[model samples]
Each structure stands twice: as C-alpha cells, then as structure tokens.
Target: MDLVTFQNTILPIKDKLFRFALRIVGNPMEAEDVVQEVFIKMWNNRYNMAEIKNHEAWCMSVTRNLSIDKVRSKFRRETGIPEGTDWRDEGLSPHKSAELTDAVSRVRQLMETLPESQRRVMELRDIEEMSYQEIADLLELTMEQVKVYLHRARKTIRQQLIQSESYGLQ
Candidate 1:
C-alpha cells in the first residue's frame, strides 16, 4: 500500500492497538511506545500486509506479543486502570460515581488475582468484545479453551462481586 492507503487502512486501528498494549503492559507511556513500534513494523512490512487476512487481529496479535516481550524485559509490573484517566459520567450523582469507580477498581483487583490466561481471556472477550473465533485466533487457543477460560473468569468475578456485596462494599 502507498502512504495514503496505509494511513487510511492502518491508522484507524491505532486506538485499539494502544488499548490492547495498555492491557498487557499496564502503562500508558509504555503502551504508546509499543504502538509506535507496531506502526514501524507495519510500515516496514507494508508490502506484505496484503497477503495477511484480518489486519486488525494481526495488529492485535502483534501488540500482544510486543507487550508481553516488553513485560518480560522489565523486572516487575503491577497495574490497573492506566493511571491518570478521568472518565466522568455526567448523569451520575457524585456519590453514585464514587460507587461505580470503587466497583470497577474492585473488579480490576479481582482480575489481577486471576491466572494470566484467565485475565487476558476476560479482557479480550469482555472488555474488547472480540468474537470467540477472533480471540482463539489472536491468543492461539482452541475455541473451547477460550470459552472455558472466559466462563471461569466471569464466574470468579461474579462470585467475588457477590461476596463483596454481602460484605457491604467495604
């Protein structure tokens, strides 16, 4: 593809790529770097891109691999909610907003406690809203395996939420 074609076809997926990278790397700045690297890789391989089907999934796989590589290079990483985000809900009362934030935080914490596969599967399936086949393709898992992981992840989170609710949302 030429420059304009590349920009039109490729540039739109940048945000999704960034979000996937951020999900893995857990740092916005690092995610940005990963995205830049992905773009560079895509540009370099632009001629070959047409041979591959499903560019979005291809991009997501690349992002996932690069982010995992980045994490491996670093010593340790603990993250959630990509710090410094302010996603305000204009309709919510302040108290309701606080509750929503806390609930989200709690769910994130619960996700952190899950195994890596389970957490990643949950994020891809629920958060990103990818189809099972797409997830299986990207994660290189069987469809049944993807379903099992997602089901377990949701079951665990649901149970945790129920437990927390019983305890009155401390």
Candidate 2:
C-alpha cells in the first residue's frame, strides 16, 4: 500500500491492535511494543500489501500472533497485576459504583479462566465487537466454527456467572 493509504487505513486501527495485543499480553507497554513491531513488519512487507484482501484482519492476526509469542517467551506468566478499577464515575451512587466495579472484575476473572481459543473468540466477538467473518479470517477458522466457539464461550461465561452469583461471589 502507498504511504497515504497506509496512514488512512492502517493508522486508524492502532488502538484496536493495541487492545488486541493487551488482551493477550496483559501489559500496556508490551502491547504498545507489539503494535510497533506489527507496523514495522507491515512496512517491511509493503510490497505484498496489495495482495492482502482485508488489511484490518491481517493486521489483527499479526498482532495476535506476536502478542502470543511475547507471552510464551515469558513462560506464560503475567508480567504484573493489573491496576485496580477506579470507581470514579460521579453519576453513580457509591453503592452502584461498587457493584459495577465488582461485576466487571468478576467477569474479567471468569474470562481469564476460559481456554485460550475460547477466550480469544470471546474477546474478538464480544469485547472487540467483531463480526464472525472478521473473527474467522483473523483466527483462521471457518465462519461456522467462529459461531460455535462464540456460543460455547458465552454459555460457559453465563453458567460460571450464575454459579458465582449463587455462591454469593458476586
């Protein structure tokens, strides 16, 4: 792709790429590095860029692979604990704020417990709000497989959430 095309198309998805990388690596700085590496790789391969049919999916797939590599190189251990959620929305009552925070944290923990493939599909479909076709293209899965994975992931999350609520963990 030309420089103008690259800037207009690839640059606009930087945050999306960062978020995808962060979802895998769980560290902001590492995610940023991964995004930079992805851009560098894309630039280096610019000659073949025109052959790509879906640049966004291509970029996301690269980000996912690189982030997974970074995590694997570190022995799959988390780099650090995430910062605590800030319950600073002035519109919310203190009790409501606490409830929202707790709910979000609980769901995040539940998501982390999922298998890698399911978690990835869930993140792309639900968190990223990507369509099944886009997710399938990125993950190298069929469209039907993406739908199945999403359904199973959501079901697992729902069941776990119900159990947690029944146990007063929520």
Candidate 3:
C-alpha cells in the first residue's frame, strides 16, 4: 500500500490498538509505547503490506506480543505487584451505589489475581468486547481453545465474586 493509504487505514486503528495494549499491559504509558512500536514496525515493512491478509489483526497481534513481553520484563524487574493510582475517591454515591461500586472494585481486584493468559482472554472478550474468532486470531489460539479459556476465567471470577459477597471480605 502507498504511504497515504497506509497512513489513513492504520491511523484510524491506533486508538483501538492502544486500548488493547493498555488493557494488556495495564499501563497507559507502556501501551502508548507499544502502539508506537507497532506503527513503526508496520511502516518498516510497508513493502510487504499487501502480503498480509489482515493488517489490523497483524498490528494487534504485534502489539499484544510486545505488551506481554514488556509485562514479563517488568515483572522480572519488580519484587512485588505494581501500584497504580485509584480514582474511586472522587465520586459521591448513595449507599446502594457505594456498595455496588465496592463489589465491582473487589471483583476487579480479584481479576488481577488471575493468570495472565486467562486475564488476557477475559479482558479481550469481556472488556474489549472482542469476538471469539477475533480473540483467537489475535492470541494465536484456536476458537475452541479461546472459548474454553474464557469459560474457565469467567467461572473463576464468578466464584470469587460470589465468595466475596457471601463472606463479606474485611
């Protein structure tokens, strides 16, 4: 593809790619770096762009791999879990809303405890709203495999949420 066409086509997808990377890496700055790297790689391989059947999928796959690599590298360098700023203190809420929000927060925390593969599947399927085939293609897994992993992840999350609600974690 020509530079103009490539720019137009790929530029529109940058935000989606960034969002996917952000969720995978759980860091906005790292996600931005991943997106930039993806576009740079794409630009470098512009001559072979036509050979790629699905450029968007290709870009996403690259971004996902790079984000996973970054996560692994960061984990190795860090001794404990990474800390991020919480924004929940900004809002005022009724008792019911507060309780529900707290439950949701707890669920998110529990989600963080899941395995990376399961968490990625859950994030792509649930949070990013990606289709099964899309997720499978992106993650290089079979559709059946994606479904199985996603089912297991959801089941684990549901069980944790139920336990937390019933026991009321202090």
Write candidate 1's Cα lDDT for 42-128 as tens digits: 889989988988788878888999999998876455444456564334335888877776767777779989999988898887878
Evaluated at residue 154, the lDDT of candidate 2 is 93
User: Residue-wise lDDT of candidate 3 within 25-143, one digit each (tens)?
Assistant: 77677788999999999999999888998889899899989998989998988853357654333333667555666657777788889888888888888877889999998888999
List of clashing residue pairs for candidate 2: none
The order of the candidates by lDDT, greatest first, is 2, 1, 3
Estimate the lDDT of model 1. Answer: 0.84
The estimated TM-scores of all candidates read 0.83, 0.79, 0.76
Shift in Å, residue 16, candidate 2: 0.9
* Residue 139, candidate 1: C-alpha displacement in angstroms: 0.8
Comparing 1 with 3 on TM-score, the higher-scoring candidate is 1
RMSD of 1: 4.8
| Range of the 10 consecutive residues with the lowest summed lDDT in candidate 3 | 85-94
Q: Model 3, residue 152: displacement in angstroms?
A: 1.1
Backbone clashes in each candidate structure, one number apiece? Answer: 0, 0, 0
Over 23-57, each residue of candidate 2 has an lDDT whose tens digit, in order, gives: 77777778899999999999999999889888888
Off by over 4 Å in 2: 76-100
Task: Quote the positional error of residue 110 for candidate 2 in Å.
Answer: 0.8
Residue 5 local lDDT, model 2: 83
Between candidates 2 and 3, the one scoring higher on TM-score is 2
